[model samples]
Target: MNIGIIPMRYAKALFAFAQDKGMEETVYAEMNQLARSFAEHASLKTILDNPVLKSKEKQALICTAAGTQVSDIFVRFIEMVLHHKREKHLQSIALMYQDLYRKARQITIGSLVTATPLSADEENRMRKMLMMDKEGTLEFKATVDPEILGGFIFGIDTYRLDASVATQLKRVKNQFMDKNRKSL
Candidate 1:
């Protein structure tokens, strides 16, 4: 009864069920919303795990957290999870479902971090360039972080290209420190 196994088992079953119902995409979106909700609200788990709160109330909270409207399939799946007292694992289940959906749909998640925001055309060009050597559709996001100082950092799936000035400067500083140590 490993903790990790519970979420994976529930997520796999939910994924298969959603696929059979042709509602996997809808459920995937709901799961992503749910995961984000959990991340943003640390007290959510504490509230959910309260034995004083009724099951129906918990269901309402879950649905509200997901979005204004969720698919019936998602509602039913949440009902089942609550029935089995697996509400505590809801966050993990949502994340695992997203992972399963991404893998099954061959969607590669990527992000670009730059010192400044790129224009629409520049962003599209960078996304296209990154996708050229990769497989499947890319779910790309562009974010601005002035802390990077300059250049950009691009990541796709498990690979990352750290061309940011901050990282480069750190590398040079480390090299100088090592050289000084060696001479001393």
Candidate 2:
């Protein structure tokens, strides 16, 4: 049983179930929070990852710590993971579940790598362009990359539009070589 397969399958199923129950938003938020918590607390994650811990005891401790912050359905999901000794896959499950949420909501997530921090106006303009160009709602996450030199690169899903100065310089260099060859 590959961890990735199990988590992704379960995540899709959970997303479907939550959507049907009209709890998709809430469930998505919960999974996101859980993922963030797991990231912030490495020791807690280590405990969950430990295979020697008895499933029942682990479930009890986790359920207690989770308190009322997570929904009952999510708690049961956690219990099931513990029962199967698959707690280590929780973060993956959460991430997959978020992907499901985004798909269902008609929201597109993208990344923008820029040479410098975008001004508020630039950020808004980019977001507007994405929204107008895309078929659905756009959610852009911007990352600063000093190496880009001057321009920006936008990526939506697997589609990338490279407008960076680095790419521009490469294209210019290629054109120069082409021109030089014609004169030879």
Candidate 3:
């Protein structure tokens, strides 16, 4: 997850290559699923990282774990990574590829966490407020977290709006503490 330029560079190249080859859509889905598989199957990395296993064996294991859902090109992509000894960073590369795909397609993935679920009208209003424009699609996932107390936390990529009551209360508490410190 903490990968840097290597994965990003690989993902950009892959994304561009897929686009040129007219396989962007197929490869994008495969990359996302590949990243998710790494997350869902913890042992996948352990198995892949086993130096005792040959590169071909590792590639076969990855392809098997990936199943027929992935395209032949994607399988070859995995093989290429194994061949280059970059298997360990495959998860990061997959994640970066998804990010690149979303960016290219103008898809913004965001999360809305609230103390409670939003009503139909409220949800629509929130969408309007957050989306700002009609060109890009907002892929929003909603979650209820009572710990927020009230309001909502809207997050998209690196940006986050924390209007939750819990956060507000913490700010007030910090202000009060600052005031008390000055008096003392």
Error of 1 at 42 (Å): 1.9
Shift of residue 172 alpha carbon in model 3, Å = 3.4
For each candidate, how many residue pairs have backbone atoms clashing (under 3 Å)? 0, 0, 0
lDDT of 2 by residue, 114-164 (tens): 988989898898888878766878778999999889888989877999999
The 10-residue segment with the lowest total lDDT in model 2: 60-69
Provide the global lDDT of candidate 2 against the true structure.
Answer: 0.81
Candidate 3 residues 99-118, lDDT tens each? 88888888888889999888
The numbered model that scores best in TM-score is 1
All models: lDDT?
A: 0.95, 0.81, 0.84
Q: Give the clashing pairs for model 1.
A: none
Model 2, C-alpha of 117: deviation from truth (Å):
2.0
The TM-score values for the models, in the order shown, are: 0.90, 0.70, 0.79
Ranking by lDDT: 1, 3, 2
User: What local lDDT score does residue 30 receive in model 2, on the 0 to 100 scale?
Assistant: 81
Off by over 4 Å in 2: 1-4, 36-47, 54-68, 162-184
> What value of lDDT does candidate 3 attain over all alpha carbons?
0.84
